[model samples]
Target: MQALIDQIEASLASRLYFLSIFTSLSLPDIAGALSSDNGEASSKKFIAWYEDWVRPRFRENVVSQSPPHIGQYIKELANPFDGESCYRFRCSLLHQGSTQHPKSKFDRIIFIEPGATTNVIHYGQINGALCIDLPGFCSEVLQGARAWLAAHEVHENVQRNLSRFAQRHSGGLAPYIVGVPVIG
Candidate 1:
């Protein structure tokens, strides 16, 4: 998991925004599956995992800012990318190769590339759409995943599931090949 996180970080640092986004979107699924009893990916697990970990990283004020459409009676906005919305986005991007989701609160999601200077656009809603800083989003997800991993590193279930997680072996896996690097 750490290796995968490192790879995502490297991809972001290298300015491979699309690749970083593609891989970053999938981390929640992996973490969610690992935290489950059966180690199978499901919407429930994904949402719960995301809510527990990644959601907290975003600032409360930003996440709570109400949209214009809400009546004055409404006090706060629904998080633009609550677990369900994020899952919708993940499906759209990974399965459909698009950012548009019919069920999503936003018409679409946009990721802003990092600026050359210190100024950066990190997160917000714009005209019924969500805009996130590409690097910042990926980094936050990685941080959340890292924290979850540290907290659960010794858990029997996570350890068991992690055994099945895809990873690269510095040396070839035993009983098949040895002495050469392999990814499986």
Candidate 2:
């Protein structure tokens, strides 16, 4: 079991590595303009270029076909505490940003699990509607959200570190996203 877990972790690491690489390469070319001496002018030019050249391509290639909607699913399971019914739902999203940055410093995968409720103890809420069991469930959900946000922060740090390394190695000519993870 330990070996299996280790293998799964290794596989996930490898996938993340490749995904980072692919994402780096797929990032728009506007990053190059950010390093120019006349950054303001270059930034404008890059934004124009990206709007004209890259945005349409990205919309075509990357955006999903699914309609924007919220959903939930429950799984029936035997409760460990007392042979009772249990349910779990996994949530995720392919999020994007809508800022004015030359290169869209945005794109991420977010994962979440719906708060669980039991017969005796109710979970606080499901999708904003109120429920009145398991008072601690809300706290657990908050913790999960904090953990996800922290993971994002750590990922951003890694990208920033890699950007610095690349800049140093390339004598300041390197683009931020080239060969670096896109964490935003």
> Largest lDDT belongs to which candidate?
1
Query: All candidates' lDDT scores?
Result: 0.83, 0.28
RMSD, model 1, all Cα superposed? Answer: 5.6
Stretches of candidate 1 exceeding 4 Å from the true structure? 60-79, 116-119
lDDT (Cα, tens digit) per residue for candidate 2, span 9-115: 35435544333322322222223232333322233443443343332332332223333441112223221211010100101111223112222112222122224
Write model 1 residue lDDT over 1-184, tens digit each, in one string.
Answer: 9999999999988988989999998999999889888999998887888788887666543444545464345544344578898889999999999999899888899987787657665558888889877876787788789999999978988999999988888899998888999988
Point to the candidate with the largest TM-score: 1
Tell me model 1's lDDT, rounded to 2 decimals: 0.83
Poorest lDDT segment (10 consecutive residues) of candidate 1: 70-79
lDDT of 2: 0.28
